[model samples]
Target chain A: MGEIVFQKPKSLCDVPLHYCPGCTHGIVHRLVAEAIDELGIEGQTIGVASVGCSVFTLLRA
Target chain B: MADKVLMKGNEAIAEAAIMAGCRFYFGYPITPQTEVAAYMAKRMPKIGGTFLQAESEIAAINMCIGVASTGKRVMTSSSSPGISLKEEGISYMAGCDLPALIVNVERGGPGLGGIQPSQSDYFQATRGGGHGDYHLFVVAPASVQEMVSLTAHAFNVAEKYRVPAMLLADGTLGQMMEPVSIEGITVEDHDKSWALTGTDCKRKHNIINSLSLLPEELEQWNLERYKRYEKIEAEEPMWEEYMMDDADVCVVAFGIASRVSRNAIKAARAQGIKVGMIRPITLWPFPKKPLLAAADKVKSFVTVELNMGQMVEDVELATRCKRPILMANRVGGCIPTPEQVLAQIVEANKLGGAQ
Candidate 1:
C-alpha cells in the first residue's frame, strides 16, 4: 500500500473518517480546519454537533 | 484570491461563515438547506467551534440567540417551513438586538409548501418574520459565489448594526454548484467590544432584552432601532446593475431567480432587445435607490421570481409606478428559465418600452 499516506489537517487534529463515497464532506472539513489553522484559533474552538451525517463528522473531529 | 473551486451554494455559505469567524452553529434538519448544517457539523469541531442540531427550528434559533448574547459569532439555518417555526425566536433575537446570522434557503410555502425552491417568503423575510416592528439585515445571494461572499458580509453587517442578519437563498441556489474562492480571510482579528461577553468589572452588566413595559420607553427603544436601520439603508444597500445604462426594460430579481434573469437579459440583448437586470444583493435595505434610478431611465420593469409576485410589490413601491412593473414568475418547485424571461421581455417591450 506504499505506507498508506494520509495527511493530517493543518489546524485540525488527526481523526477517523465516517463519510460516504463521493461525499465532499472531507474537502469542506479540510477547508474549515485549514482556515482555523491559518488564523491560529485551534485551542479556543468549541463545536456543536447536529443530527444526521454531521453527527459522524462531529464525533470524529 | 485564486482560481475558484466548484462548490454548492449551501457549502459555500458554511465555508464562508467559518472564514468570517463564526464559532457556533445551531440548526435543525430541513430539505434544501441541510447541506449547510452538514458542512458546519463536520468543520466546526475541527476548528474548535460549536455546532449543535437543536430539537427544532425554534430551539435552533434560540441557541443562536444565547450564543450571540455571549458575543460569540453564531448561525442557524432552515428551509421555509422551519423558518416560519422560528419566527417567534427570530423576533425575540431582534428585540434583544443580538447580532447573529440566520439563513433561510426558502422553499414554497404558506405552510410546508414543499421541499423545493420558492420566493414566497420574500415578504416574510423583508417585513420581519416574527411579530413586532423590526428589520433583519437580509442579503440575497443569487449564485454560489455570492453565497460565500455575502455570508461573510452578513456577519460583518450583523455585528456592525447589532441585529440579526439573514442570508436568503432558495432551493436552486442552495443545491446548485459553482466555482468559488475564499483565499484571503483574516478571521483571527475582529472587533468584539460591543459583544455581551460578560460586562466584566470595566462596565455595567450588559442585558440583551426586547421588553419595555412602559410605552414611552418602548417608543424610545424603537426610535433608536429605526435610526440604526436608516443608517443601514443609506450605507449597506447593495445590488448588481447589468447593462442598465441604456436599458429599455429593466428586469429585477434576486437569489437563484436573478441568475436566470441575468441569462435572459443576455439573450434578449443579443437580439437587440436592450434588456438589462437589477440583481439585489441585499433584499432588506432593498436597494431601492438604484431601482428607483433604473425606473427613471427604463420604460418598464420586469420582476422575475420563483413565486407569483411577492417582490414585485416592493419593486412597485420602490419605483413608485414611475414605470410599469410586470412580473414573470413560477410557483412551487417550478423555475422560470431564461427563455421564459426573454419571452416576458418581448411582451414587456411591446406593451411599452421603458416607462
Candidate 2:
C-alpha cells in the first residue's frame, strides 16, 4: 500500500460540516484550519465567529 | 505616590485603565474621544499589550468581546453616535455575561448630533442601551481625578460581577484638561474558569456565546442575570452628597452638569436658599437610597442636565415624586450654566414644601 499521509488538520474538528453541499465555505474553513495547524497555533487560536453562516464556523469545532 | 500631572480627561481615563492592568484596547476614533484611542495606540505596544483601531465602533466592541471572553481585560471608547453603533455587541456581552469596559464620551445626538459636550446619553447608558433585559455598570465621572479612580473602579466592578461596565462621560469631560494623579489604582483579580482558553483536547470546550434557541433557557438566563443586577443595585449605588443637610431644595445631577450644579448650589447657599446637591457617581444603580432619604427632608428637587430632562425622570422615580421636581436643562450640544441651574434652584425653593 502507498504511504498514507493526507488527513484532516487537527484544528478542524471531527463533527460533520454544516455547510451546503458543494459550497466553498467548507474549502475556506479547511484552508483556515490548515494555516492554524501549520503555524502550530491550534492551542492558541481564538476564533471570533460572526453572525450569519459564519456564525457556525467555531461552533462545529 | 506620583505628583499630580496635567492631563485631558480622555488621556487620564486611558492611563488609568492601563494602571488597572488592562492590556488590550480596541476602539475606533471619534471626535472628543479620539485621544483615548491615540493614547492607547502609543502606550499599548510599549507595555506588551494589544491596541487595534478596528474599522468601526461595532468591530471595536466585538474585538472587546473577543478579548474579554479570553479572560483578559479589554475596553473600547467612542462618542454618542459611535456608541449607538456598539449597542449590539454591548448587549451580546451582557447576554454572555462577559466583563468589559465601554467608554462613551458623549456628544449630542438623536441622530449624528453635533460633537459637543452633552449628557444626552444618560438614558441610553443607565437604561441598558441595547435591546434586552440587561444593564451595564455605568459610572459618570465629574472630574479628571474621578475619571482616574472610576476607570479602575469600573473595571474592578465589572470583573467582580462578570458584567460589562461603562464609563459615561461627555465632550467637556473628554476634552477638558485638569490636574490628575493616576497613582495607587489597583486592579483586583477575578476568576476566569469559564474563559475560552484552548482545551488542547484535555477537557470540554468552553463556548462564549449569546444565542440560545430555547425560549425557556433564554428566559432563565435573563432571570439569572437580573438577580445579579439586583445584588449590584443593592450594593453598588454610589453618589456624592454636597451640603444635603439642612437644605430645603435638593439638586440632582451627574457628570458635567453636576459641576455646574455645584457652583449654582454654592451661590444659592449664599443667597440663603438652603439648597444642596446630590451627584450620582453610578448612573445605573441611580443612587436611589440617598435621593429617597433626602425626599423626606427637602421640599423640592432640581435636576440639572445637558439633555432635555432625561435624568429628571430618574430623579422623580428615585424620590417617588414626593417632592415637586424641576428640570434645568439644555439639549442638542448645549449645557446649562451655573446661573441657569441656580435659577431652577430658586424656583424649586419658591415651592416651599408644597407637595
Candidate 3:
C-alpha cells in the first residue's frame, strides 16, 4: 500500500470548518486559498469577512 | 502583498477594491478603463460580491448610489464621455453624502472626442461634474501602483467623510502596465454606523436621500456639506516634491504628464539644469501650501500636462502669479515627449526660471 501524505495550502489555515454539508462556500474558500498559494501572496492579502455566511469561512481560514 | 506584480492600472483598481472589502461594483464598459469592470466581473462572484454591468453609465452610477446607501463599499468606473453621462447621479451621491468610489479613466475632449490618453476632464472632475455646489474628493494616480493605493484610499476617505470620491486617472495611466504591491494598506473595514442597515427596532430609520426641497432646509444642507468639504481640503492635501530642494525651475504636473515631467527633470538635471516637480496625489485638496512654498523659492514654473493647461490655473492661484507659469501641453490625444518638456524647461530657465 502506498503511504498517503497530506499537504495543506500555505494560504489556508489548518482548522476545522463549520460550513454546511456540501456547501459551495467550502470549495470557494479552498480555491481562494489555492489561488493565493499559487500567486504566493498569502501574506499580502487582506481577507474581508462580509456580513454573511462567508464570514465564517473567513474565520475558519 | 509586499511582492510586486505587473498590472494594468484599470485591473489594479479592481483588485485593490476587492482588497479594500468592496463587494459591490456597478459600472458600464468604456475605454480605457473597461478592465476594471471585467476584473470585477470575474472576481466579485467568487468572493460572493455583486458585479453588475448596468444598461448605461447613468444606470451604473445610480446602482452604486443604491449600494452605497446600504453602507457597503461600492464603486463605478467610466471614461470621459461615460462619466459625463453619469454626472447627475454623481451629484445625487454628493448631495446625499453617500460613500462610494467613482473612477474616471479620463480621455480627451468636451464630447466623445478621442480614446487615446488625455487629461481633458480636469475641469469637469475638479469643478462640480454634476450640478449644485457639492464637491467630489478627486484623487489622481500617476502610475498603476497609485491606481491601487489611491483607489483603496478613496474608499477610506469616502466612508470616513461620507462623500463620493473620484479616482482621477488619464488614459495613459489606465492602460499603462507597471509593477504594483498588493499587500498592506489595501482592505480597510470601516465601521458602517451611518449605513442604512435595517433598524430591527434598535435605532431610528436612516434616511438616505438628497431631496430637501424647501429653500431654507436645502440651503442648510448645502452649508453643512460645504463645511465637510472645507474640512477635507484642510486635512487631505497630498503631493510629492521631487528635486525641489535646490531646483531653479519647478514643474507642475499630475497623472501621466507628471511621469513624463519626472523623466524630463532627470534628463535635464544630468545636463546641470535645475528642474523639479510637484505632483498632487489628491486633486481635490490640490497641495497648495507646498506649491506656494516652492513658488516662493523657484524663479518660474512650467506646467506640463496632456491637456491645454487646466491645472495651471490652480497653480497660478497657488503661486498668486508671483512667477512666470508656462505650459507645455498636448491635446486631442497626443502626449508631449520628454524632449518637448526638456525644451520647455530650457526655455523657462532662459526666461528666468530659477534665478
Task: Report the CAPRI category for model 1.
Answer: incorrect
Compose the digit string of candidate 1's lDDT tens values, residues B1-355. Answer: 6888999899999999998999899999999999999999999999999999888888888888778877888899999999999899899888878888999998887777888889888989999988999999999988788788788888888888888999899998899898889755544444666555543334543455666557998999999999999999999999998888888899999888888888888889889998888998999999999988887787888899988788998898999888887788999888998999999998887766444
Comparing 2 and 3 on DockQ, the stronger one: 2
lDDT of 2 by residue, B152-204 (tens): 99999999999999999999999999998998798898888889988775677
Please rank every candidate by TM-score, starting with the best: 2, 3, 1
Screening candidate 3 with a backbone cut-off below 3 angstroms (N, C-alpha, C), the clashing residue pairs are A44-B1, B1-B182, B1-B183
For model 2, state the Cα shift of residue B61 in Å.
Answer: 1.4
| Candidate 3 docking class | incorrect
Q: Model 2 residue B212 lDDT? A: 72
Query: Which of candidates 2 and 3 is the stronger one according to TM-score?
Result: 2
What are the runs in model 2 whose C-alpha is more than 4 Å off? A1-41, A53-61
Runs of candidate 1 exceeding 4 Å displacement: A1-61, B184-194, B199-202, B353-355
Tens-place lDDT digits, model 3, residues B78-180: 9999999999999989988998999999888878998998988898888968899977889999888888888889999988788899999988888889999
Per-prediction share of native contacts kept: 0.00, 0.53, 0.00
